[model samples]
Structures are given as structure tokens and as C-alpha cells.
Target chain A: MASRSMWRSLHYSAKRRVVSPAQYRCFSCSLRAQDQGKTDSEKMTHFGFTNVPESQKESLVGAVFSSVASSYDTMNDLMSLGIHRLWKDHFVRTLNPGSPLARRHNETEGQGWNILDIAGGTGDVAFRMLDHATNVNHDRQTRVTIADINPDMLAEGKKRSIATPYYNTGRLSFMEANAQTMPSIPDNSVDLYTVVFGIRNFTDKQAALNEAFRVLKPGGVFACMEFSKVNNDLFNAVYKRWSFSAIPLIGQVVAGDRDSYQYLVESIEKFPSQEEFRAMIHKAGFMIPGRGYEDLTGGIAAIHKGVKPLA
Target chain B: MGAVILARPGRSGVLSSLQKAATASSRTQCRQNHFHPPVQYRKQELPFRAAPTRSCRLYHSQFHPRAPTHEYTNSQTTILSAALEHIPSHGFTLEALTLGARDAGFLDVSVQLLPRGEFDLILFWLASRRGLLRAKVEENQFESLRSVSSVEAKTKLLILERLKMNQDIAHKWQDALALMSLPSNIPLSLSELHALSSDILTLAGDSAVDTAWYTNRLGVAAVYASAELVMTSQKPHADFAAIEAFVQRRFEDRTALAEKITGFKQYLGFVGSTAIGLGRSWGLKI
Candidate 1:
């Protein structure tokens, strides 16, 4: 019976309604409100570990990324011990963006395949995609657009990309836009939509996924790479220790920001699991086959993919 | 400031509407206003539940259902093709598995996807090649031999044809053989041998069901193992004709031994029966 009550509490916790603090004074008060079956307004969501007004989530996330934009690449290397490179490489190669479409657009040059990389700050995935499509596939008609909600992040990406041949060759471009609504990207225009290590920062993850579905051409792929729940208990213990204690210290030493790194770690934990996220993709009208998500590194990170159906 | 935020509420409205639509479309029970707490907070608050267990609710959730069996087979085929490129250079090492996983775009930590590590990958490669050999034999190569050849001749043809498939990876086969030679890997090696022999026998239409079944399989396995060793030891430019000759000689020796054993067994049975009859007809008992 004790276990039963604990499970009930957990179930409630998982679906904890984000009510304004004005409605419920404290955590206990919120529990009481739930017991009384009172429904609260949807004006609250989480900011790190704190429940803040929903209006503030976007800016809070923006502040966190802006604070770490310059040190983002370095921090990623330190945090994951440079395994992120292998992950990104695998991510791009899996997409193999132009292998199929390159044939259809052989007469049209490199403009046939369009890739929209959402929240791709600093052009990590974008550069890799361009390299794979150009060097590996020998197709020059693939193009990539790196979109980020934070201008600071976009600036950092633009600065880094200025040195590459793809910078101004009409093959690569950068845009500043919220993932939830990219009004500039026309419907059914993108062939591959990728969001890497960036979806957890979105205020409305489902809305972002919906936008992904809207922008993708029929039969296009939607791929995401993100930190996921570590399935192994012992590994999870070690990973948690490293993420909470060491990562923020590394951030302070390297990026001179502690709170932002703390926020990043917190956000990763708050993100949905592989199965839940796959459901979100499905809810957005994307078709997925068989579990939809593949766990990487013992579920420390995962890749989820879905295809827009051709009706 | 508040009015400015609310004045252009287009984005929020769009988001809310989209959320509603998502909730409606999702087949699973929609959690109203579900907010995931930060991991750190959850760990501190729910120590007992902090471990990442696959939840029963998740299992029952019909969110993203698993694909059918054939889709997994297709995906495995894709992974195998990517893995083949790395095997020739890296043998069957973890490095090869890593490269293959990367080429297949598996996310980090997905090395576990090939759970038994290098052994599993080696088995997969062997099985895949066996499949290809079967297709080649059935589709085009063995039609004429099937109608006119003896079982020994058919077995020789299949073994040689399969061995030829390894020519591309001859340099890497030395490393594979070394790994397979380890004491701990004996079981896996034997299993691989059994699979190969069974596949070859099936292709050759050798359907013996008596004690000959065991002998036929063992005979083919021994012949195939010896031929593999010989082929691997041969230099790249060494006479291909010599390997064929060696295989033919080995098959002939096995056939000759089998015939001699059969002849000896028949003679022993005849002598035992005559002795029994002589004892029954003996006048000493009268």
C-alpha cells in the first residue's frame, strides 16, 4: 500500500500541472489542489529546477545559451570527452542527405536537396552535412540552413563559418528564428530536418516538432540527437556525478559561467525520454517505425528519427 | 511591458493550438500539462525511484510502436554493408564496429547495438556471405552440375565457390583465423563451422537421414576447414588452379575412405552371420 501511494504520487508528479505560484503557495499546496481536483491555468512551466511563468521560459533559455555561446563548443568537448564529434559525424552520415536526391538533381547542380538544421548553434551539424554531401557523396547540389533562436549563438556560428568555402557559396546560410515557429521556411520545402542537443531548450517541444513536420517535404526525414536517460543504474550514478559536480566546475573554469552550465544539465534531465519524444514526433504527424529512437552510449544520448509520409 | 508581451500573442496562440492538436492526435492517454522536473531535483526527492527503470507505463504506451520483423532485417542488412567496408582493414575489432556504427549514423553509446561485440559481428559477416553464396549457387552457377554430378563433385563445387568469395578479404582472413583459434572461442568457431557445413549440404541437396547424416556433415566440415586453411596460407599470386587441385584431392581422399569403411563393415557383418549359422547347425549339440 505504501508502494501504491508512492506510485500514485509519481504518476501525479510526472503529470504535475504547472500552476502559477499565486494559485498554489507551495509544493504541498499544489498537491492539495490536485487532491481537490482543481484545475489550474497553464501559465507556469519550469526554469531549471524552479517553476516560473511560462512567458519567461524562452528568455531564460535564451539567456543561458547566450551566456555560453562562445564557449559552447569547448564545453561540449569537455562535457562529453569529445565523443560529441563521433556522434555528430554519425548523425550526418546516417542522414546521407544527398545520396538519393543527388541523382534526381544531377542536371540542376547542388540546389536539389535542402536541409534545415534547427537550433544548430555554431554550425557543427551543418558543416558536417556539407562535408559529407560534398566530399563523400561527390554531390554539389546540397544546401544547409542553420537556424537558431538566439542571435548570439547565430553570430558565433556565422563567425566560425566565415572561414569555410561554403560560407558564401549559396550552399550554406544562417538564420535567426525560434524553432516553434519558423515562418520564413515554406511548407514542404525541406528534405532533411535535424535538431541536435538543442530540442531540450525549446519552450514547447511539441510545437517545434510540428514546425519540423510542416517544413519537411513528403518523404523527408526528421532526425534528432539529444541527451537521454541513461538506462544503467551504475552508469547513471557516475554520469550524474560527473554532470552535476564536474561539468559546472569545468564551465566556470572554461566559460566563466556556472549557472548556465547548471541550467544545461538540468534541462537535459527534464527532456523527455526516447519513447516519449518519439511519441511527440508521431503526434506531429511524422511516421516512425519500431521504437523510432535508438539509444547511444547506453542511453546517455539517443537519436530519434521519423519520416514525413508521402500521401 | 505586460501589454507589449500580450499585444503580439500570435506565437503563443499558435503554440497553444498546436499543442491541442498534438494532444488530440496522440493515441496514448494525454497527460494534461505534464511538466518534467529537473533530474537533480528528482534524484534528491525520490531516491527510491531515482534509478532509470523501464517503466511499465512506457511499455504499455502505444506512442511509437515497434516496426515489424522484416524492417529490422532490412536495417541489419544496411548495417552489414557498412560494416563490411571496415572489416577488410580492421579485421573484426571494436574499431571496426565503431566505424560501422558511425557510418550507419548510430548515436553515441550504440556500440552496444552489436551486443556480443566482435564475435557477433564476425558471425553476422559469415552468415551474410553464406546467404550470398546460397543465392549465387541456386540462381545461376549450379544448374548444370545438379543434373549430372555426384554428391562429392557437388560438394567440391560449392566449397570452392564459397572459398572464392573470400578472395577479396584474404589478407584480413589471417587475422580472423587467429581470433577464431583462441581457446575461449572454440564453441563459436565450431558453431560457425556447423552452420557453413549445413548450408553447403542443403544447397547440394544432400538429404541423408541416417547415421550418414552425421558423417556427411562432418565430412564436408572437415573438407571445408582444411581448404580454408590452405587458401589462407597461399600467396596472393599463388596458383588458383593448385587450390582447386588440392580441394579435389581432399574430396577424393574422403570419398575413398568412406567407400573402404563401407566395404569393411559389409564383410564383418557377413562373417558374423555365417558364424552364427555354423554354430546353430553344429553336430556337437546333437
Candidate 2:
């Protein structure tokens, strides 16, 4: 009886709103508004009828980042519940981060290497990478340029960095940057480029790829962790319910902004599936020789990795 | 506002008559108002009060929608127009004829005509300059024949083939034009110029002809406007000598290209410097 009720709840929770194409457009516009940082232009784009301007994106993003930045590690713990950490861990594992071969061309030496993180909210990947990199070559110098178009997210990253031992080591810094027009970085300089939980937020994926490819060294590495398509029919059905029915309401209660969370749900649905995304990576000039999916409860979230050749 | 009947001093019949008279007059007035009232009339007769008009509603609603337009400089606009215009005119202007051979509908013919047409253009100019005025301009007309004759077959070639053609022609033009830039003391015939263009084009690195593979390369070329190669041997400005030596040494070392690009960037860190830096990094000799 409990299992049956659980399935029923999942179905209700993940039941799609069947958003009209018009609503989808409004949702997209609201997303664009969030990135552009416009508010009060209430001819507002609807993240689901909450009408927001393109200018409010920063503050809206800031709110989320501020709310979670301190607990970001906690939220990743609760939301994916502990799954996000494992996914990130898996991503690093696939990178072969400690291999002697990666260390040989360590042109970065004492001052270390450079990293460009796209939509890298709260500096999770940057912080995690710094932790792992230090273990690999303690004397090796490395810096992570953690950037997100969201100031709130960046602020959270900043706040969290101040408190972490990693931050005291002077290994990580935060900056506000659009995925499309990443600034202050030269071409072919970054050794590893990453985006975590942020790919679906971009308005133009190809432009983001072009920019990522632009800033990366010819043989740099690129990886991402995002919500992905679930593979098992039964689990997918349950996961869908959990996402749709409860996530927005949870947003309403927790973040006091149900609309933003609703936009999140819609965006995740619209994001390219895992295989389709692999092709995108390939198109972006990365040779994705290896790939793995966590298949978290039939694929609600996944980790993907792609690498630029080191020729 | 609805009309309100008022108490009046009169018998029931008189009251009814008065009410009827009032209704009759109001109906007539409403009819008059509906038809053609004076442009400006006194408002004393009307029982209902008027609402104030709102004018700001329209103006304050939203900002005027601006037309989205792609911004390109006049020079860029001119180049695009000139390139487009030349694509159909087989062999008139040097740039146009080359572009046309690539754009012309016949794939086989476009492929064949591109080299031949370019050769003819070079040959015709050479002959005219060398005073061999009798060798007819139309002497190599067969060069216009394409690899395929029909549009449907051309369509069947897929996007890959079209892309391949674009890359192939662009590479050919690159080499031929580079050689053409070489200070020529010897004037060759149309056939010889054609052969030389073909030979040089064939000799270029294989990756040069794959447009997909050459995204960075093409972007860099566009930045320099085809001056990248020429700039390698000759300095266009003050740092030309240093840049030439730096470029040559970097080319020899291969691995040092990244470091050299950074060096060039530092040297030329003026406004709009990224374009040049990006171009050099993409393996443009400059």
C-alpha cells in the first residue's frame, strides 16, 4: 500500500503542467530577464505569471546564491541529497586528475594552472577541484576563476570561499560573467573549464560552447554536472512527479519565489538529453572518449565529461 | 450613472405626465447626442457626471519596440555585397570570379570552373600585360564545365559536400592569391598560371580545406583580411622586422606558437588587438 501511494505521489508531483508554447516563450523570456538583470518591465516575462524584467536576474540569482552559498554544500547534500557530491567526485575521477601524465606537462608549475568555470554557482566545482589538485601536487600552483553571470551566486561563492580552508590557501576567486561573453580571459589559456548545474540556464548553448572553447587551452578539459533524462520508465515516472508537483511549491515555501523554481523545472525539461548533449560537446571541439551517467533514480540527475585534446 | 426619479408636487396623473415629459426630453437629447451634437455644447442638461479621460495610459504602457538589426561596418557590408555580386559573374573581377566559381549552381562545373576560371583571369591579365593580345580570352572555355550538371544531383551531395567545396575553394584562393602577391618578374601564360595556382593549392596542408576544422583559422583570416601570409615575409609597419623574425622562429619551434601568440599579444595590446591575436593563434603565418 505504501509503495502504491509513493508511486501515486510521484505521479502527482512530476505531472507536467502542459505549458502552452506561449507560456514556454514567457518562461524563456523570464529566464533571459534573470540573466539580463531586468525587473519592473512588467510587461513582465512570466516564469509562470510572476512577470519579471531582464534586469532582476542578478538580484534573483543573488538571492538563491546567498540563501545557499553557506549551506550550498548542505543543499547539494539535501537536494540531490548526497548525490551531487558523488556525481562531482565521479566527474573528477573520470578526469584522471592525479595521473602522472597530467602532471608532466604541468607548465603551471608553482604558480599553478588556470581554470574558467561557467555558471559555476557558489564555487562548488572550483573549491572541490582545488581540494583535489592540492592533494595531487601540493607544491603545484593553481588558480580557479569561478564565474557565473549571477552576482548572487558569485557572492555566495565569495562568502563561502572566505570561510573555507581552501580559500585561505588563495586558490579560488569569484567573478560575475555571462556564459556567452566571458570576460578578462585570453584565448587558449584555461587548463580546465567546467560548468556545474548551470548549462540549462544559458540562452544560447552554442555561444556558450564557443566561448568555453575560446578560453580553454588547446588540450584543456571540460566537464558538467546537471539534471539529466531518467532512463527507467517506472523510476522516470516517479521522478517526474517529484520534480513537477513538489519542487515549485517547495520553492514557494523555502525560497519565497515559486516562479523561479518553476522556471527551473521547465528549463530542465527543455535541456538537451545526455546523448544529444554529447554531440554538442563533440561539435564544440572536444573529444568525448569517455562518458558515464549516474542514473540517479532512473536519471533525474547526471554527470557528463568532455575533454579537449592535448596535441 | 443611472437616472434617479425625484419627488414632485403634483397629482398622480400629473406626476406620471411630468415623468413622461422628462423621459421624452431625455430620450430626444440622447438621440441628439448620438447623431450630431454641437462640437462644443453646454453640459447643464445631462444628469450623469462624466468620467475623467486618461491620456497617459497609452504612452506609459510600454517602451517603443526597437527593430532588431545586425550591426556590421560599411566595409564589411560592402565586402559581403561585393562577394555576393561576384558569385554569379564567372570571371570578371579577381575576387568575384573566384567567389562565383564556388557559388555557381553546378557543383561539378563549379569545382572545375573555379580553378580554370581563376587561371584564366590570371592568364588573361598576364597575356594582356605581356602583349600576347592574340591568344583569345575565351581560349579556355571548357574550364567552366562543372563536376555535375544537374541541381537535383547537387542537392543530393548533402551539407558535408557543400561545406567541403567551400573549404576547398577558399584554400585554393588562399594559396593562388598568396603566389599572385609574390613580386612577379616573369610573366607566365594563362595555362602556366593556372597550373601554378593548382599546384600551390594542392600543396597546402590538408586541414586547410576543411571548413569545420578551420573555424579558428577562418576567423583569423577574416580578421587580417588575407594579409596574414603576406605580413609574415614583409612588415606592413614599424614592428614588421621583429614580428617577421618572431613569426619565423615560432613557426620552426611549433610548440612555441602559444608562447609567441602571447608575446605578440603583449606587443600589440592596443584596441581591437584580440582579433589579431586570435588570428595568429589559429596558425596564420603572421
Any idea what lDDT model 1 has? 0.65
Q: Candidate 1 on B37-149: residue-level lDDT in tens?
A: 43333433331231112222211112333211111233334455677888867777766665665476542123433334566566667767777877777577666556656
Q: How would you encode candidate 2's per-residue C-alpha lDDT over B1-286 as one tens digit per residue?
A: 1122333435477656755665566555555433444323322232111111111111100122211111222222222333445433332344453243223321111111112234334443332322221111124222222354443222222211212222313323444454455555123332333322222222121123123223323322232222333343442233444433543343344436556877888877764577778888998876
Write the residue-wise lDDT of candidate 1 on A104-199 in tens digits: 233343254688988886787898888887887676878899998877667767987988779888889899898989889899788788888888
The TM-score between candidate 2 and the true structure equals 0.41
Every prediction: chain A TM-score: 0.83, 0.73
Model 1 DockQ reads 0.03
Write down the C-alpha DockQ for each prediction: 0.03, 0.01
CA lDDT of every candidate = 0.65, 0.46
Query: Model 1 — TM-score against the truth?
Result: 0.55
**Candidate 2 local lDDT, A1-311, one digit each (tens):** 11111111122222123322222233454555556744443443222234455345334433333333333232224335466666666555444332222332433342455767777656666777776667754524667788877554566568778876766565677777788786678887776777777776555577788788788765465667677788888887877796688766654554344444555666567677988886787678764432323344456766655545434
Clashing pairs in 1: A110-A140, A110-A141, A290-B66, A290-B67, A296-B108, A297-B108, A297-B109, A297-B110
Candidate 2 interface RMSD value = 28.1
Q: Interface RMSD in Å per candidate, to 1 decimal?
A: 11.7, 28.1
